[model samples]
Target: MLVLWEIYPWRNVEVKKSVLVVLVVALTLIFPLNVFASVQIQRPVYVEGKRIAFDISPIVEKGTTLVQIRPLYEALGLTLSFDPKTREVKGGNDKYEVVLTLGSDLAKVNGKEHKLELAPRTIKGHTMVPLRFVAESVGNSVYVNTDTKRIFIGVFMTYLKDKYFDMSWGLSKEEVSKINKNDHNELLYENNKFLFYDTEFSLASKKNMVPANKIYSFEGNKLSGAIVKFNSSDDFDEQYSTYTQVIYDLNNLYRTSSIYPYDKYWIEGDSIERAYREVYKDDRMKMYEMAVRSGDLVFICPFDFADTELALFLQNKGTFSKPEYEVSIMYEQNKEFFNQISN
Candidate 1:
């Protein structure tokens, strides 16, 4: 008894601690803790940051986003019932009730008639209605990224000037030092302005987004501009394709674009092979440069500030230096910052 008591696991402080740690680990494995982070599940549509997959894919008809009524019933939290006799679908929660009729571009919401973007129709034998209208009527806002072709319902899509990930514009360096991250992994910063990257929808796994470097420019210790730079040291052709998509992604937010060519070999809408041919046309100087802009906020492809007027300005300010890259695209921002030097 004395031997067993001396060797007893709980009787020993170290042994008791080890046993507690093992038990806690086992319990944790069985029941994992939920930590807040950006939604990683990839889907065509997201409701409140949660992925919702529809049986019949949603489509845009006449510029109106249409989705199945049945699947969204539970997702959006509404008690829905279809009436075959009147060819009307009735859905309601405590806040609002909606009545939709097939082939009619009008709906009854909370006893009030509201016009819909597109009339409800049967596609693949399932009832479809305008997603934006239905969602908004139920107190959920909807946002769509044209380039990504992803729909966000009940998620606030912050303006580029307002927010990026969990970080907001006008944040001080001290405030941003503790970023919410929102499931995105942080990368090392190069210049004090560039705050590295988010690595979830990041990388080719793109299981969602292509990884890109994010630069947060600060003026007077407050965030002034947020820039995203995409580059590939891989094949030139692949780089061209990636930049094309990157530009498209920027366009989805900014809408219009203007091209600015600086280098001599610049060609508009040319192939990678052609661009490569142009860049190496003379080994004396191999330079590829141009910028595609939408107002003050936009994208710069192959932006090399080195050996340019901008380079001199940046050097004078000691804010930016040239980065070596084979091919790249930088989505830039802030009228205040650009107004200083872009002229």
Candidate 2:
């Protein structure tokens, strides 16, 4: 899991003392301190399709579900600390901080005091907090299904976003053909090594009055790469700038670094010529490659380097002219795929 250090702004408000006392009394009577042993097993909590096993199971009090603090917080890559003297639990990263005191409706997030719907409390030696409040506070969307008695947290992906269109990933070729029936250009090629989808997609370019034709590639039922050919009339500098901006936006979104001078290499050619190859990678060995040649910019990453090397050979042929460059933003799917392959 990536550690999100982005600080989320939270508001602070004062709770009426009388209202706090009445709420505490009602909760105490419903969920007595000694009743932890008798409490039945509750519905499980899932984060992004994975079940979370808590040391002490989640419980309900006054219609609000409460879950153990350490397990859930740590699972989200946040550090948690507890102070027995003050009964305060402080957790979060440098970007945001959460401070909750036992049996107190008031909590401090980033040093700003805010009112919690239900005060955090200890149950059977484990600290429990309001499930919805804590989960949503850390940038996760929470959904409760009363019919199934289950809680699901995080975004579920339905389609993969590409430069021109949102394509369906993890779906078989036949499944895609059903929905993309109008796209007569859709072609499939397969061998013992892998399956491929060659579909023509078009997007507006600066020099072309009409949208230029681009072919998007799918391997193993996933949108893996794309080949964008640019018209000779297009300005080279403008195309480079456009590609650079796309790289910048991808870096910002994925929190990954763009290919820098230190990571760049040039082939034996004119000194004024730009490096034809660039690679973007994180510490985890996940890679994305961009190659500019002839009039085309070919992109392939998480695919073998041999594929990228073949692209370099094709670029050397100069059959293509100024290539339209666009980065494939598949950070989430790529991360998931890389982990599955590595493990």
Candidate 3:
């Protein structure tokens, strides 16, 4: 089992709170703890898919990734403001806002309190704050590719922000066919709702997953969803381990812990055999769900926002002895699906 630090923000959450507070989700991560020197930024930071050039450059002091406060805020669409009198910095656009003291670890987001593992400070005439804290606070995703030694931060609310594979969202069949002219495996479903491309998918640039089917689901001849389903004939333990890693990967890239509060499951014993038999079991003693959600903030406030759910799932279709594991990442982009279905 890949051991992890209990540093995830939602890990300490109580079950009594059914709804995961936004503040907690903002701080949730399973980052490896390691200290380092105040060297020049070895890893280049990319915000919203654009590489940011800083005068002083980003520095990693004690394992925390710190960046120049102003550029980082503006990249996230937040206008930066500072109060010299109080040593405070404020940044916001309209819906999202952040206020923090120069030397304090406490931050205020939309009038709610959030704690940073590292405090904001001045380094070589530039103010620096924990990069992960600010990005994840306003519903953005942050990931560091150790292989590439590059930092990727996405300012997103749902589904990678208008990213739908090689094609953009809301494209017609004619538009898609022109963009991706490569020969595909499958053409159409019975009802002509899906188009499949038998290809591999790389999650957060970490692992290359060879999927059984990479599908593009359509609604009214317009692209509505992009899905990748994987199948494995591995044993129960191996399959379960792979599934959890996938979930953790997506958790950082998408907003989930706020809705599901992942700590509730697998807190006591994370081993596959124990978790499968003990916590997740059916009435027939078969198995509980290994599938978890990677939905956006739409899950928290169903009435307010359109729901774009990046649903991640793992299932043991066959028995334990001859287990047939099914792992899938499904994206359902239904703009008004919530409003139409709800009262």
Top lDDT model = 3
Structural similarity to truth (TM-score) of each candidate: 0.40, 0.39, 0.41
Q: Considering every candidate listed, which one attains the maximal TM-score?
A: 3
Steric clash pairs (candidate 3): none
**What RMSD does model 3 have?**
15.3
lDDT of 2: 0.46
The count of backbone overlaps in candidate 2 is 4
The superposed Cα distance between candidate 1 and the true structure at residue 101, in angstroms, equals 1.6
lDDT of candidate 1 over 22-127, digit per residue (tens)? 1111111111353212112122666754557687766564577678788787789889998889889999899899999997878999999988866787766878
Which of 2 and 3 is the better model by TM-score?
Answer: 3
User: Mind giving the per-residue lDDT tens digits that candidate 2 earns over 1-343?
Assistant: 1111011010011111111111212223346453332233456676755568898777776567789988788766678998999998888876778888998889877788888877888777888988777776666666554333557665433443434334543555455445555543444544332333444433333343322223334455554433333322233345444444444433322222212311222233334133332233232111212334443233222111100100111112233343433322222133433332234
Q: In model 1, where do residues sit more than 4 Å from their true spots?
A: 1-43, 157-165, 168-343
Sort by TM-score, top down from the best? 3, 1, 2
- Per-residue error for 160 in candidate 2, Å, reads 7.3
Clashing pairs in 1: 38-182, 201-209, 203-211
**lDDT winner between candidates 1 and 3:** 3
175-265: candidate 3 lDDT, tens digit per residue = 6656655554444442366565565444453355544566776667877767656655545454455556666655443434234423233
